[model samples]
Target chain A: MTQHTQPSAKALVPFVSVDNMMRLIHHVGLEQMLRDLAGYVEDDFKRWELFDKTPRVASHSDVGVIELMPTSDGESYGFKYVNGHPKNTSEGLQTVTAFGLLADVYTGYPVLLTEMTILTALRTAATSAMVAKYLAPKGATTMAMIGNGAQSEFQSLAMKAICGITSVRLYDKDPAATAKCAANLAGTGLNVVICTSPEQAIEGAQILTTCTADKQSATILSDNMVGAGVHINAIGGDCPGKTELAAGILSRSDVFVEFPPQTRVEGEIQQMPEDFPVTELWQVITGAKTGRSSAEQITLFDSVGFAIEDFSALRYVRDHIKGSDFFFELDMLADPDDPRDLFGMVQRAAR
Target chain B: MTQHTQPSAKALVPFVSVDNMMRLIHHVGLEQMLRDLAGYVEDDFKRWELFDKTPRVASHSDVGVIELMPTSDGESYGFKYVNGHPKNTSEGLQTVTAFGLLADVYTGYPVLLTEMTILTALRTAATSAMVAKYLAPKGATTMAMIGNGAQSEFQSLAMKAICGITSVRLYDKDPAATAKCAANLAGTGLNVVICTSPEQAIEGAQILTTCTADKQSATILSDNMVGAGVHINAIGGDCPGKTELAAGILSRSDVFVEFPPQTRVEGEIQQMPEDFPVTELWQVITGAKTGRSSAEQITLFDSVGFAIEDFSALRYVRDHIKGSDFFFELDMLADPDDPRDLFGMVQRAAR
Candidate 1:
């Protein structure tokens, strides 16, 4: 009898845990990592037509929703499993948690699996700042960060790293959240101001980022508050029945979104009629359409998040972890000595 | 600044790797575990109406396909990531590999993560045998196992444990596969016979199971090869453009399927017309429909596998790991003392 003691190397997959992800972020430097991730996001956007895009598969319940966002670029496939429960905060848990996987399209074998809660934060911010690079007003140095939550600091730093923003004004309905955001950015080289009101946060800022955590249609930015030549990065208004910006603001701004069919149901544009005109961000990134045509024109990136951004983030992580000790091999696949003898392998394990 | 070291308990999810799963199967005893898993699959089938079912989301490449199958039972959500690459065998890789996750729908937090490659085999065999228990002829004891591949032994043992089978006759196109299967089943209590031809293997057998792993359509069983009163468990004719049984066989048999919408595209019934009449297996389990009506009736279970079976398998693992040292806690989620201070959490980790 031949003894099969250990699984083959093919059974192992690289897994990046949350602790390792934080370590990798620090090792790469947060700002530089954000900048690098933004480059990947921009590159993917340029080739978005090649991706197999679909709206996220979501299972909605009364308290929250669990979603699977999957996309393939023909060579590799990636998906992120994420859950959003606004009520989790009350129970001392994160409102969102995620993990992602990347696999080889040829062999259908997973190449990487990583915790994406922190990575999602990084990618979302990078995607926002990347879009702003093509749509925000020239020489924009100030951002009005409304709803200072878990995503606020990342958004602020991403803007500073990618868009050269030097100042961030933060505001949230909860004063403690605003204070936490201010403290987190204390020595990040950016001038951080804690604002008491949303109106005050937007004062004299050329970029307005609204990322409230509410699951309802609360107007964090009214039409009157958003001035011309400012780029509105509206990410908080994701999912149905959740809109942070006013309908009039969307009516006046030249709205750009990450996939129109999805944005029509989940983004801020959901409040608009079905036939409302909006440009796909991929077109703008590819130079097929004009962006920021005039200094006084309002550009709204109605960002509801997309699968391609996660695919690019997965690609970046898979590439970065090649020569780094940032990931560990997980015995996640069953590789029998002979592919047809899975039972014999299990039976031999008892020996 | 107060120092926050280590992630909170809520941030950790229990992960059962392949080694631990093998250990778990051996600890519980293989046949007993099969019976137990069959119970869970049967229980889930009885309450099938309570489940949220959707066709698997597949990403097809020229060489293979990757899929995400997700389902929820209102309180708990489950998903399995699986891939199939038939060409992988020549490269010494398994044709299929899988992993699954179970999460709490209320809080939207994952509670269990496990390697499902082995579990999927167990669940697939258990589901087949459980359905045969209801549909196979009374006092059935012999099964002709066609396509002696990775799933053959598991199918044989599951039928022995759950359906009172005492003998298995195995045949495969590759004689080496048949030799390996016979060698694996040598010490088992059941009478195992190795046959050269599929016809010789099914002589007087009360059950027939075909599980060939080819991506293209191949007829492993013809209409004249089958007789009345035998249960046919056709499992490998899954996915589009792949099938195993002749259309004449399906035309003469009363077919039972897991999910009609899915089976129409992936099951052996894919060769059948779209409006072809077939009873759902869940209805038979719930006593809402008939199983085997007479000794001369041929019952064919068109098993393409479904998310609910994977969900039930996940539920079984979660329950079985409660007080056992079969899993390790993985720090997969980012937990901050303040849910809104994720950036602060990462920043503090640097210190």
Candidate 2:
């Protein structure tokens, strides 16, 4: 709306490039980024009722999936399009990648375009850690990390920052992935142990994390593998027909979710009934409900990654980054001396 | 996909901007762009059965409309979000502005982000003219244009190109718009006559084009003003309750629509019955059905604008524009070397 004195949010748009974001990560250590992002994600989730919500619109393909997750609060609007292709790794590609838009709701003009690939990992870990903060027992020092792949280190770092996790037992089908995770966490001050199986990883670990990327239903955590007073953070089984926990694991826990309508179809709770009683975490954060009845209660945080987390991540990036050289300046918004003269723009540009 | 050694249509994704598009316009001329785009739109319509079509998903606001119109052909996919706020003109903004995404259906990856603000104007004109090519009478020479605002010139140019319109009668509630339309058509070799009233504009004209931008159900064309053998190109009355034509005008005409389901909701036929008989223009273009039946038949092209037209415009731009350091290189797709190592990208970038 440059043509008139209309309200514009152009000044708030943060343009963070992949390289610039990489630089930002280096300047601020990975541990700090994960912890800070978790704080932001948690703070936003606590006030979740103030925001608008919607189920994601997904366009799925046999090889991959692309989705548009949009939400607004009558002030700002954000949407993320992410893709997941389990077999992309065989072709030397990342199985999940994303980009997002942050716009001003008042003007309906996009103010930011960000590479959310790295940010998604950070936010996912932060969200999991936040859930653990409320549900996990005090002095929880050891975490069982199933799927020691791309998301393993973030989980370990967040738990260490928020839940005082000083030790981690990691297990994955690919031993190389576990080895990589161990090496990455070596200087981070956490004691990492490579376990042979999910059972071995769960031994004496108070917090269990399942972040596998299998496209089909596979029980990484069964009832036998879980224990009392342990909080389960299930991450990887995010779409229909894809799940991690066994039915027995879900049947024995006080399940909690971000948005119930979507979680029922895509969360680990997809194995459960339609009338399943699950708590929206916002209520817990807002003190309207409780996260754990007691330390002995089995609390399962069904983490299917909601749109609100992305909104918070985008807000965090916009707030933390200030240098403007890394962003693309767009003429996407149409400006006429008069809004009625849109046709005049083409004519002028033609000249 | 550009990483592939062997080239395929799926491998080359084009990203065109307003600047790049203007260069295309300057090189090929607007008339040719309209003509070529019309052929492209017609060609796509002929293959209508190959498409995956749906009515646009709209998010409405008090001031304007923002929508996502998505369609696919199992190979390529496209979506566009455009807003229209007629009162936005006094603030020096265009009543309608838009941008859209073109993606690969096989990978569900966004392949292009083109400026549909300008492209929409082009496609709207082309579709109107192409429909006129099929439905307007033989040797149609004059067009009466009501509500000569943003879309007025497209109507004039399209009718001039396809239906051999040599003279146009123009009237708008606002006089400056008519002046602007007259200035844009200068030296275009068509006779442009400014009429003070809608009745004066429709005098003995073979084609009547209505492109108003009112938000109410204001009748701009009465039944008595429209006679037999007069093809009406209804361009503006798209959203609910914003129609320009009286129901009597639609009742007397054989309606041709882009998609019947959508046209029934957003076109002039919104006030009509659910069982109202209408022909999908694509069927008529493919000769699976009929267009103008006889010399006395009146045809109405209910042009609410569709996504396939944007797909065709993007395809045309992709074919015409070569990236020799004159385009926006968007990060619409992820090209990770090892898809499984998504976390490593952040780590490596941190380095």
Candidate 3:
């Protein structure tokens, strides 16, 4: 066999670290990045029919669940490895952690690998706000954040950037969490209000986002507390039996979801019967279905988080990191001079 | 809100690169590593009922298929991302490439991440040899390796290490591939012979291993080519519509498989009926099923490669990387002082 003189290609995959993710978010201001991510997600949702869709493959344990969400757009493939363990926070660890990769479909080589815990937060918020862009009442300026945990500030900023919201009311079962969220959003140019009760928080709000971190079904928002013409972004009801809104709220609202098959199993719809009617969010984004039919119509965005959002987020990071110091190359693949001579390469490496 | 003085404990994941994988293999001699990996795989198989089992999630395109194989053993979870594009070799790329991760099932923190392109080759060969040790006829020595591509030398070395094979005869449709395998195994202390045809390669050989890399079901070995008292290792027929041996051979031999659900779809047994009797190799390992029934029996180990093997390989690597420079830490998770204050963590990082 002829030997090539070039050094091993040793396929290098660009890796975005947690620190660099923060740097990238800061480089592009937080609100603008949220807006930019919303655009990418909207573009993908508009072309959602072209994507390979599958419910996340999950391994559930007694205490937590780890899932692999994979999707492809014919040209590129992406997947996120994420886990949800609400008890982790009590043990001094994040309740949710994630990382993802984008690979070329043709060559099957990974192009980007990134920490997705921060990005997931951004994309989830952006997705909620993007849906609200179509579903929320016109001139909506205030949002009631019922669970001021990790996602409260991001959801607020995204709504502000995407839907022109100017203020947010934060409330949580734990006052410390509410204080931390209000403190974090102090300088984000949005009016931050610390509400003593969920009902008080939603008193004059046009949007209500529920993002509590718990593994059980809890009535974070009751039906009586919800008013008409308000868009409810339900994010915490992501897994089976872990819903935040009362069933009466979903019964009265024209619910929308990312993917029905997943939402039926994981989202707030899990509380309803299998025949529960929900609009595919893509259809609403594509204008095939009406988002908010009238000023007094109730709209709820039941988000379980789909793979395409992560795919779009990965694509955004892949595109933005070119020639930037926000990423470093990882020598991750064995690219032998002769692709068929992997053994020979290993033998020579002994020298 | 009070801020903690400690640094963010963003979960650090350890990564093993291609270069580091090679170093690790050499640090522990190649043969010993194969033997050690086989032991881990065998140990896992013995307790296979305790594992979380599912068929691989695959996305197939016209050119290739990318798959995510995940499995958990209650304590740790492991998954491999692998792709196979047969035409990739003609374009000077590997026909297969892979990487994998192992994570803690408790906290969902990634424990180890490593490039599995090289490791897959090693683990595949080890798994084949380990199965051969159980089913090969007594006193088996010489083995015939048709389709001498990337996996040929490793299979030969692993057979020598685990199954006590002393010599190998190699043949490929492309003589250049045969020559490359022969040259690579020159100083490996095992006798290697280059043959012009599959017929000549199997002469006087007790084990027949076929690993041709084609996407279609082409017969590399006809039924007449097989004799009694031999163990056949079939590796290339790992996807639907891809098979190496003639159907007559499968009908005549006692078949053993790993994960029947996956093997029946991807292995050579796809040619057989749904009820075709095949022994699960794990059952044989645990003494629940017979391996080699008699000296005159023909046994075929239909090895389609399963998630459990990858899990075991990952477990072995995770155990062996302790106090070794073969890995580096990756800051892959976002850990905040207040777990719910991820937004605050990013805000603080801007300073």
- Report the number of the highest-lDDT candidate: 1
Best by DockQ: 1
lDDT of each residue in B1-351, candidate 1, tens digit only? 223357788999999988889888998999999999999999999999999999999999888999999999999999999999999999999899999999999999999999999999999999999999999999999999999999999999999999999999999999999999899888889899999999999998999999999999999998899998899999899999999999999999999999999999999888888999999999999999999999999999999999999999999999999989889898888888888888988898888
Q: How many collisions per candidate?
A: 0, 11, 0
Q: Write the per-residue lDDT of candidate 3 for residues A1-351, one digit (tens) a residue.
A: 123223444488899988889889888889899999999999999999999999999999988999999999999999999999999989989889999999999989899999999999999999999999999999999999999889988999999999999999999989999998888888779999999999899989999999997899999999899978899999999999799999999999999999999999999999999999999999988989888889999999999999999999999999999989899888888888899999988888777
The per-model lDDT (C-alpha) reads: 0.93, 0.79, 0.93
DockQ versus reference, model 3: 0.62
Candidate 3 structure, TM-score to reference:
0.98
Candidate 2 overall lDDT versus native: 0.79
Write down the C-alpha DockQ for each prediction.
0.65, 0.38, 0.62
Those runs of model 2 whose alpha carbons end farther than 4 Å from true positions after fitting are A1-14, A322-324, B1-14, B323-326, B331-335
TM-score of 1: 0.98
In candidate 1, residue B195 scores what lDDT?
95
Over the stretch B289-343, how does candidate 3's per-residue lDDT look in tens digits? 9999998889999989999999999999999999988898888888888788899
Model 1 pairs whose backbones collide:
none
Give per-model CA RMSD: 2.0, 4.3, 2.8
Docking class of 1: medium
Evaluated on CA atoms against the true complex, candidate 1 attains a DockQ of 0.65
